[model samples]
Target: ALLKEMHAAGFEPNAATYNALLGDALQVGDFDQAWHIVDVMETTGPGIDFYTISILFKGYKGKRHSMDAASFDRTLGLIQTYSVKVDEVLVNVALEACVSLRDPHRLSATLATFKQCGWTLPKQCAMHTYATLIKAYGQTRQLDHAWKLWSEVTERKGLTPSEQLYGQMIDVLVTNNRLDDALQLFEEMKDVHGEHLDSQGFAVAYAMIIKGYAQQKECTKALQCYDQMKEHGTRLGLVVFNSLIDACSRVGDMDAAARLFR
Candidate 1:
């Protein structure tokens, strides 16, 4: 109705105007309405731009779990059908959707499409981008690919890995059951990036290691990690406490579990 009013008022709606409506629809999870807008944009003038593509991908940001393959494919199809010029923001949004969906094939396809559209990681690309790609590979159980990206980021001259990057790498290693490797990287991250991490960062990094130990039934190591975490002034959270309690219970140490509970 507002669009009709705009037309009646001689105010022609362009890509930006439609992009706003598209963003609003996607933000509210009104994908049907969003798609209808996309259809209108297709039949109208002022065709889709990179911003339009980015907005479309952004709709799937936190809603990837509810997204189906067909929806994903349809969005990807837009890029080709409109020949949308790819940009870093658009590429990142698409990559994130692929990661959230845990679809390695689509992840690879997205990367390829970005390359075909002349998008490449800049020399000073954000560490978070590499971190996201590493996580995507990790989710797909492509450990080698994850490690390669990690090495690329770490080996880059004068580019320090962010705490989030370190955490994501550690998480990938631990999730792959490579506890020893995760621990080694954790130590490296502490030596280099520890001063930069706040109490919350310390808690998160320590939590991952502690939980990894607990999952392996190494209750002693988990407790030792908790001790170290406390020494770092990180207030213990419920996750850490629960993992410790479960670890103690798993080892048939009710007494230890009671002590932790207390």
Candidate 2:
């Protein structure tokens, strides 16, 4: 019905018409046709403005985190060209795209721009965002990037790295065979009195470091770290001690392993 009007009115289907049709198609999950309509408008460009581009982004925001970077660039261009006021929701939506896509390159860029625009992220949410980026990198065995961001998290994240984040880095460092650095990271996570510092910090940081070192066949370092843990008045869970025993057994130090396991 509307197609007939578009055909008769000779309006040439500008961005507004494209957006309205896209919305209707999306409402019924007619996604393939929705994309087709968007592409048609893009091909017929210069008339596509911020509101139109933003409408398309709204449609794809959750479904495709790592969409064609070009699409986001086009949308951002629309925002700039139209002098649209930026807001937290917009920045967050961009970040959400980064998280789902795990595209650190663009995510990092967006985070910087978000700060430049005077958007203050909540401490908790910022930690999660950074952690998510790091974890995604770690999953891909991209330790260099992961550690680089981990350094930023510790030095300037405006919040203590959560136990989970710290644990993730420890795992990555161990994977990269950089056991000493991992142990040092674990130490930095400690507080003045030598406690694990934050709630459950030891559970993730200390325990994971020990496990990683053991897996790396560097049981000595693991034991050394365990001793340090005791000196700091942190209670060692029996499972942690058992892990050390297992490490010793793997290296033919059965006596030491047996002694601890006992």
TM-score of each: 0.84, 0.46
Q: What is the lDDT of every predicted structure here?
A: 0.80, 0.65
Q: How does residue 131 of candidate 2 score in lDDT?
A: 64
Clash pairs detected, candidate 2: none
Total clashing pairs in model 2: 0
Clashes of each: 0, 0
90-197 per-residue lDDT for model 1 (tens digits): 767777777767777887787777778777767777777888777877877889989887877867554677788888898889888999999999889889876754
Global local distance difference test of model 1: 0.80
Ten-residue stretch with the least lDDT total in model 1: 60-69
- Which consecutive 10 residues in model 2 have the weakest lDDT in total? 191-200
Q: All candidates: CA RMSD in angstroms?
A: 2.9, 8.8
